[model samples]
Target: MMSVRDRLEEVFERLEKRASDERVYPKVYWAAARAAADAADERRRAGVTLGPLDGALVSVKDLLDVKGEPTLAGSRIFRDRVPAGEDADVVRRLRQAGAVIIGKTNMVEFAFSGIGLNPHFGTPGNAIDPKRIPGGSSSGAGVAVAEGTSDISIGSDTGGSVRIPAAFNGVVGFKPTAHRISLKGAFPLSYSLDSLGPLGRSVADCIAADAVMAGYGALVSTPYPLSGLRVGVPRGRLFSQTEALVADAFEASLRRLSALGARVSDCDLEDLLEQMREATSRASIASVEAAAIHSDWIETRAAEIDPRVQKWIALRLATTAADYIRMMRKRDELTRAMDRRLAPFDVVALPTIPIVAPLMAPLIADEKLYNKTDTLVLRNTTPINQFDLTAISLPIPDVPLPVGLMLVARHDQDRRLFEIALSVESALPH
Candidate 1:
């Protein structure tokens, strides 16, 4: 077995190598990590064990505060901003758990896009296929883990930001319900919808990381029995416009689960879908909130903002107070409608994305293509956010292309969702 010191040193060495080779991480904290690593090693030598993530290497999204480091949130807009006074709540927890805090990974500008593209700091290419996107706003967090620079990545998921990248990059991403994890020092995309999650190589790794971030000591998830487990599939909208490869693999996965004694059923989601449609009829709660957060910057520093991001934030200016109030009301109604609808089933399963990671070239060249593709990429995963639910995206094994199987639960059912996800993850091909 490798000693904690040896493991962390190895991780830091890899971080340096990865930093030189890729644009995934814009900053590196070797000095801090080295000090933390030595401390963890000392604790181990004294027979004092740390938390579950003791001495593990971890990277945070730049959207978080790391005490003394200015969070760029993947934009040049904050290049001259002052350093943070303290770590974000999640980062503080990780440090307490003895994790070697490496450095901040890059992200989409202000976490506005599902497709990870940052003109200021280069977009991190996908690990599996460099030609395709690495999904974002947690883009670099996903790639850091995929490239083995970090054992786990702590990221924020507002609207498929975490899970979309996980699917596209072929990893596991778990988004806990909003308010479950502290967001005190993290930059906000949508106050109402934002949640913290971890992207890792496996379901168990994510469980461990989540426990640390949630201040729950260690991971305590147990696998639920798969036999006779009721897995619901939303009948419509989820599968519309899905690429053929994703459709086939998702159905095949269901068949495999059924073979393993799990009962698969198509859920009657007409009413739930209607509520969701109303909830998201116009500008997202994110755009409005982001507009509030960045309006001053957009007004005076318009040239500094990403055009795509600026356009979305600017839309929030057009949102009247009446529109905001109606949106909130619809949000409440939809959350309740989906919660009641999911109460009877153990979990709901859907394709994480109806499509694979789209190529980056065309999207970069054409604004129209970027808008259409971004909508498609976020379609399946965004509903979980609208309903204030928790979800995990697990890659389908043995598939010709990377496809994620998303399992969802009602709000605050994060533990139950993890148990269910583990069982399905085990049954699915690696």
Candidate 2:
């Protein structure tokens, strides 16, 4: 194997060639990355390897800490913020596991949008189609993984930040159950909902990154037999209203799984999802919690922030405490009910997004169009977060633009979800 330093230098050269592209990174830590990799190479010579992830190049989202870099979160508001005093908890763990940190990827401003539009740093287009949105808040993370700049990209998924971009970029994105990884030193959009995850080329890559982030060696899921596995398809808007090509691709994936001996059936999760939608509609925890975190900045620096993000956060001033309390109570009840509804199946399947990546030009030009498209983009993936569950979105091949099939599992059943995804991924024809 080539030395880790060699690999990191190659990545650095490639990044420098595309120095003007903000879609991929905030800053390239060429020296630090090379130093880390050199240390790893030394350890390798001494027979002290850090398992499969040793010497790997990885990307961190801008919201994550990295000792001396400012946590921009893709907005101008933080240009003057002090540099971090130390690496975030996840960065600390990745370093210990012998991974070389390449750079910080750009994201939606404060991780509030699903469209990945960063007005301050310029919106990063989709890797598959430069004209389309690359899925939000983890936009640059997805691009870094798709273009092979990083072995894995670590990002946060408050709603669909990780999975949406993964779906758009044709990579595997895993959103572990909240609390599975530490959030210390990471900027929070909604501390109540923010959770960290990884985007990579395959399920195995995500599995390895997740393990390392949790302070361990790579985790392995036992090979599960496809035969007799029960996968549920929820019957409602999640199953309907999908674009022609997207629906066709999702159905074809289901057929392949069924042919592989898995029992695919439709179930009524409308009540569960509906309750979640209603509660969130009344008052979004993301908006209220974001307001709390930005109260000071919103008062003094609203103009410096993205206008759309600013408007959304400002609306929290109108939210009543009673409404927030009611929403939380309802969310708890619906979460329990949804878990029970999905308990009978090994996994629940859905199209990660109702439509493929949309062109950014028209959406950005029209507020109505942007809002409508953003809601559609987030509709399917947000419910999983509301229920505090885990999910993985796997890319579906044979399409012009990428499409993803999401497999959702009960809260804290991340390992089980990975196994199910592995079986499905293997069954699909590449």
Best-matching candidate per lDDT: 2
- For candidate 2, the clash count comes to 0
Using TM-score as the measure, which candidate wins? Answer: 2
| Error in Å for residue 172 of model 1 | 0.7
Error of 1 at 189 (Å): 0.5
Q: List residue ranges in candidate 2 displaced over 4 A.
A: none
Residues 283-307, model 2: lDDT tens digits: 6888888988888887578878888
Please, what is the whole-model Cα lDDT of each candidate in the order they appear? 0.87, 0.88
Global local distance difference test of model 2: 0.88
Q: What is the lDDT of residue 98 in candidate 2?
A: 86
| Candidate 2 weakest lDDT stretch, 10 residues | 215-224
Task: Show where candidate 1 strays beyond 4 Å.
Answer: 14-21
Model 1 lDDT tens row, 219-289: 78899999999999996888899998898989999999999898899888877777767766788888888
